[model samples]
Target: MNRKRCLILGASGGIGEAVVHRVIEDGYAAAVQYFTNEDKIRTIQQGIPEDQWAGSFQADLSTKEGLQAFFRVLPPEWDAVVFAGGHMYSGLFQDMKEEDMDALYYVHVKSLWMTARHVLPYMIQQKQGNIAVVSSIFGTEGASMEVAYSSVKGAQNTFVKGLAQELAPSHIRVNAVAPGLIQTKMNGHLTLEDLQALENDIPMGRAGTPEEVADAVGFLLSRSSRYVTGQILHVNGGWC
Candidate 1:
């Protein structure tokens, strides 16, 4: 298998970390992206050999400057791009402030668009590339308290589907992985009882691990799934 260079956005997050490792294990070099988590990024650098590490770039996906700064540091081309950086805010939609809503949109939706804008031209030139976004089960089956988060995730899913078709002619495949209930820092707000209640809703009686979702992303990025495009592969274990 040919080793491709992959740039993983949000490499400091829970799912991002796993995807980074999985991509590396698949024989690809990684360019890890981060916001403020320098420690984690450093850890990743330490684990991967210097030759296989394309280096990490810091950028706040929620800010225009951050986006531009990251793009400025990014290489002109990559073989694979994975968007795994996003945050979820739980609250009644009516109670959500304009700032919170805007943050969600910029972080989840805008960042993806902007990052792709910078990278797609490079991919187009190559005529072959892969893209993956980490979506949520809530994107399809909306959540009550997480209305804003759900909204943006929904947009991400649609973005993957639409962009996949538009880029397919160039042999640039795009897909998404929608994870149900993953044990990550994103769920740290939940109380034990709340967590138990949420777990009860899953048919599997448990939540998914980051590695499991990473496994799905790894498959989608591989030649084995080259025929697949514009699909939302659910890693929810029959939850939704």
Candidate 2:
């Protein structure tokens, strides 16, 4: 008997790492993908037992060829896919250059589209699989000074919704998790005051944890959410 397998992109990030642990704990094999974090990737691999079907691959998500190459290295069959790779660029819309927009589009929108194009065929052929993409609250309601980042994420949010409807007949469910103000390396640039100000804005009065978002991913990928698809689960501690 072979174990079910999952492919996690951006496995070195805070939420991605938590999702990896959740999937493994749920008794599924995982193929972790990371870029520019060899040490962290190695540590994560060591934590998994050798007998489990686990492996790591490195790929830049800014190009189609890179995404294709990443998928080429994975197992032929995967029961689920969690796309957690994205980049954030903040600046006033007028100050944002074309290059900045291009970079965000590539990482947040194009790469995810390419990865799904590459992997969806397998899931469609099997007529059963789960696909989850990590989005952000900024996607839902545009963020100030982060116009490009918000736009790209908004596109992703729309993509998952439309894709879900199209893939439903084939039994391939597509959904997204939109996180708000999660404490991660991504937020390292923020000052202490900035953090507190953002926390105050949330109705729940604090930022969410990667583990909390990961648990949402876990639910969407499990039997519990078997009938749930084409939805955006917001894990934003009441932050709109």
Candidate 3:
């Protein structure tokens, strides 16, 4: 490929969609992973120049079969992989269910580990690769009603740090972008009063854009951040 190439997980989501554009804008061809929204993936894929469209894969990511299917479909080599996929649970801890928690674990933590494992052989052989995870500020500071979600985000943050160091000698860079609060469908369930209240708490008094987070991610995946790794770059309007 003339430019760098990448695979981004969760292209159907708001942040994922924005990152796809940003990666392409920075001159990278891409492959996208979608869970149940094949239509959206097709739309995004169609928008890219045919030459820059790598391919698309669909998988649950919360189950072994799905992860295997997804990984099996990946090209033998790519310049980067962005774990831009996640789920959120925003209710009191008492109401959380066992199955839901398991889903959170698999999607946020397990999938990342498995992804790294799947790509390690290729990246190590190439002696270089970039992994940028989409994390959230909730991971840094606990949120009152989102204990489980925050916990998962915290796990992602810690995992990025550990993995970066573990693979640094091989020249593979790992980093994460923790969006403070973003205006996305994930937060669409929030009541107007709740969103406004949350925004008021942010120092900048606004929710961030997915494009902003994507830009930070683009930096991590580019030569610009060659010397940077194992860090959580916050994109949350200074909320945390």
Task: Name the best candidate (by lDDT).
Answer: 1
Candidate 2 ranges with C-alpha deviation above 4 Å: 71-76
Which pairs of residues collide in model 3?
none
lDDT for each of the candidates? 0.91, 0.88, 0.90
CA-RMSD of model 1: 1.3
**Native-to-model Cα distance after best TM-score fit, residue 24 in candidate 2, in Å:** 0.7
Residue pairs clashing, model 2: none
Tens digits of lDDT, candidate 3, 124-176: 89899999999998899989989998999999999999999988999999999
Candidate 2 CA-lDDT value: 0.88
Model 3 per-residue lDDT at 68 = 79
Q: What is the TM-score (0 to 1) of candidate 3?
A: 0.96
In candidate 1, what residue range of length 10 has the lowest lDDT sum?
A: 63-72
Name the candidate that leads on TM-score: 1
What CA RMSD would candidate 2 show? 1.5
> What local lDDT does model 3 show for residue 109?
91
Provide TM-scores for the models.
0.97, 0.95, 0.96
Q: Which runs in model 1 stand beyond 4 Å of their true positions?
A: none
Over the full model, what C-alpha lDDT does candidate 3 score relative to the true structure? 0.90
